[model samples]
Target: MFCFLIDIITYMHSNTFHIIIGPTIVKSIYSGELTYDSDQFFRTGNTNSYYYQAIDIIVNITGNYTVKSNSTIDTFGYLYIYSFNKTKLSINQVTKNDDKSGSLQFTLISALQSGVRYIVIVTTYSPDVRGPFSITVSGPATVGFHVNTAATKPSSSVTTTTRTTTTTTRTTTTTTRTTTTTTRTTTTTSKASTTSTTST
Candidate 1:
């Protein structure tokens, strides 16, 4: 009997928005600063210039994954999974949330293809609402599969079973899972308020 095992690791970053190319799971709490003239901007309306900071990660497995951003002040979190083309990049999945009076959290539950680069952005609800914050990415670390060697002959004696175990670590941040099916695509967005928006 021969056994084959495959290990996958996802690298994620925070704060300075630096890219670390390697193989490992990332779960870190960062204390950073944000301002009106920070970095990238995700414009939804014609009000203020919404500034944002982004982190790029390469995913090698397909499964349900969650990303959380917690802050002392009101904030917003945005996630974008896309691919690059000859001229520009095309977005595959986009999720944004401004709920939970003090933080924002969103989950991407879709079939993520292997060898694809995904970008995750964490920002405030509006411009100039900046302070210390922490961001985390958690989900299944490995995806398992089994193959039977005696496929040519039909026999009831041969049995193959595969099991997958997923473990999640809990923190102060609240998590919400959003499911996305293959047949339909949905996008959820909420309008930012000047004050705090109570969660219902």
Candidate 2:
């Protein structure tokens, strides 16, 4: 039995521009800074004019989760998992690095469900590129169960009994028993990979 719970919420960089940088709850390693008027309200559509800044993570324990971002320039990483009274916008993972060498990274591996609440968005794909960024979350704190058992025995057994008596005396006895039962089922399948890296 193993259980590990992590909750981290931090936001401190204020000049009043709609502060809400984090729904904030991360397992480990969170550092922040994204300039050029930080809040853009998370809208991705209509021919690219980038604007995104969001952070909110709450994953109590389910299994297989990783959200990563490292930046110093050209950055873009977005991973979202909602649906806890926030109207449902579940699991959207995005990363950018379209032929610009390096320095923007995003990695995500899903399969999370145990008190679920996730929203991580770090911007600057293009639209006033910023500086200093670091976000990290590693996997497997819990959510694993495995049990297997198999048994079979009884190779040989034989018994015979008969009785007979003479002159108005008679006895009869016969017994035979054999039993076997077997059932088996097994299934396994797993695959999780989401990674984006750029270096310049």
Candidate 3:
């Protein structure tokens, strides 16, 4: 009798599941203009004067952001946290940049946080420069830009009321006149000169 051989077979199966996480990027652009009416500030240790515009930054996500400017004027950028004081040019400053992508534009990279208020100042490298400037901010989420309205003074309005009474036998005459006076101060300065003039 022939011996029977026993054979054993085994089978195995394997499976894998993978998840990839990537960063989210969002871009926002703001178009603004700088004129003689724009806010002015002097850089530290420099007698040169500059006209600037302060923009309030509000973010929805916390991440690194790239803030850039596109303008014909030589642009200078400053990033600040909490508040931005025009007089105190260096206080609370997070970062600053002069030029990065050429065209005399400035690019500033900063780590921004959510729930925190930030300020971005766009200025010129040269003194008394004014023009149109566009800003682009790219981060994890879109951001909101609010121009600092405190730089512009609010106009006040004055109202006057007049009353007149007349009798049957007599007549009354009344004259009402309103006069408005506006006073402005003009100043002239050079790159190396700082002179102010007030006109009354």
Q: Pick the candidate with the highest TM-score.
A: 3
lDDT of 3 at 77: 93
Global lDDT scores for all candidate models: 0.46, 0.49, 0.75
lDDT of 3 by residue, 91-148 (tens): 8999998988698999989889999999999988888888888888887778888888
RMSD, every candidate, angstroms: 36.3, 41.3, 45.9
lDDT of residue 192 for candidate 3 = 78
* Minimal lDDT window, size 10, model 2: 145-154
Q: Model 2 over residues 1-200: C-alpha lDDT tens digits? A: 23233333334321212212212233455566665555543234443345445666566677666666666666666565552111222335433233233445656657777875566666666775666666666554422211111211111112222222222222333334567888888898899999999999
Which sections of candidate 1 miss by over 4 Å? 1-32, 40-42, 83-91, 100-111, 142-200
Ranking under TM-score, best-scoring first?
3, 1, 2
Question: Clashing pairs in model 3?
Answer: none
Candidate 1 clashing pairs?
none
Task: Name the candidate, 2 or 3, with the larger lDDT value.
Answer: 3
- Candidate 2: RMSD to truth: 41.3
Residues 1-200, candidate 1, lDDT per residue (tens digit)?
Answer: 11333333333312222222333343323334455445534345554465455555445465555556666766676555653121221345456667743335333333445666566555666665666555555433432212112121111111122333333332232345577867777999999878777898
